[model samples]
Target: MEAVLPIEVEIPSMRVLAETELEEAEWAKQRCEQLNLIDEKRLTALCHGQCYQQRMARAFNARVRHREFKPGDLVLRKVLHITPDSRGKFAYKYDGPFVVKEVFSGGAIILSDMDGTENALPVNVDALKKYYP
Candidate 1:
């Protein structure tokens, strides 16, 4: 005796269910591919962003010159604090028509009072801004 579907109706319904399952599998695969494509796009955009950032940094560095102060050159020293209190934050951040007394090979500059008589502390070149007179 062979196993047979006494009701032909059940066989067609099972075939339909199988077809739907196959469709679902195809949908899942396509969705995965789409997700992968999206990830690839994001990766490309990230790489481009990094490249743009590097170019911006290079341009900024190129335009900005490294400070070189010679003796007798007047420069303004950046004041980290104007007062003992936090009120200094709102006040002038830079002070001085100070004169550069000496320049060190280590990027430190010895500043003198405007009268060129008194020597101040050695400060890094970064802290000194050129004074325009």
Candidate 2:
């Protein structure tokens, strides 16, 4: 039988190496100088950018105004995506041209058919499309 020599393995410690520590220190110094202080001009520019964004958002919202329908008002109800179990599956699609039964805030309108069947459907302000003559 031959004698077998066991091999010894060497492992390094998990601490940060010398070169990596030096590089990290240099990076920290550069970052500290870059963000030392904020000047008045920079602050003013940031504020101006924020204001411009807000104004643009407001203008976009104004273009799509919500139309609230009062009771007895004529409006068209949108056709919804129907499934097999839906009650309106056999009903007329886009069964609008109906009278408004009630009006709610945020542009929601309740409508009733000529046969007195009423549906209170909550819709977004943009969904309430106005039909112009």
Question: What are the lDDT scores of the predictions, listed in order?
Answer: 0.77, 0.59
Q: State in Å the error of residue 20, model 1.
A: 10
lDDT of 1 by residue, 7-75 (tens): 422322334435546576665565567668778989999999999999999999999878788988999
What TM-score fits each model? Answer: 0.51, 0.50
Task: Evaluate model 2: give its TM-score.
Answer: 0.50
Q: Which stretches of candidate 1 lie over 4 Å from their true place?
A: 1-22, 70-74, 84-122, 130-133
Candidate 2 per-residue lDDT, tens place, 27-103, comes to 55644554553355578899999999999999998896546666876666566667676676466565457766777
Which stretches of model 2 miss by more than 4 angstroms?
1-34, 38-49, 82-94, 130-133
The weakest ten consecutive residues by lDDT in model 1 span: 8-17
Could you give the C-alpha RMSD of every candidate to the true structure, in order shown? Answer: 12.0, 12.1
lDDT of 1 at 131: 90
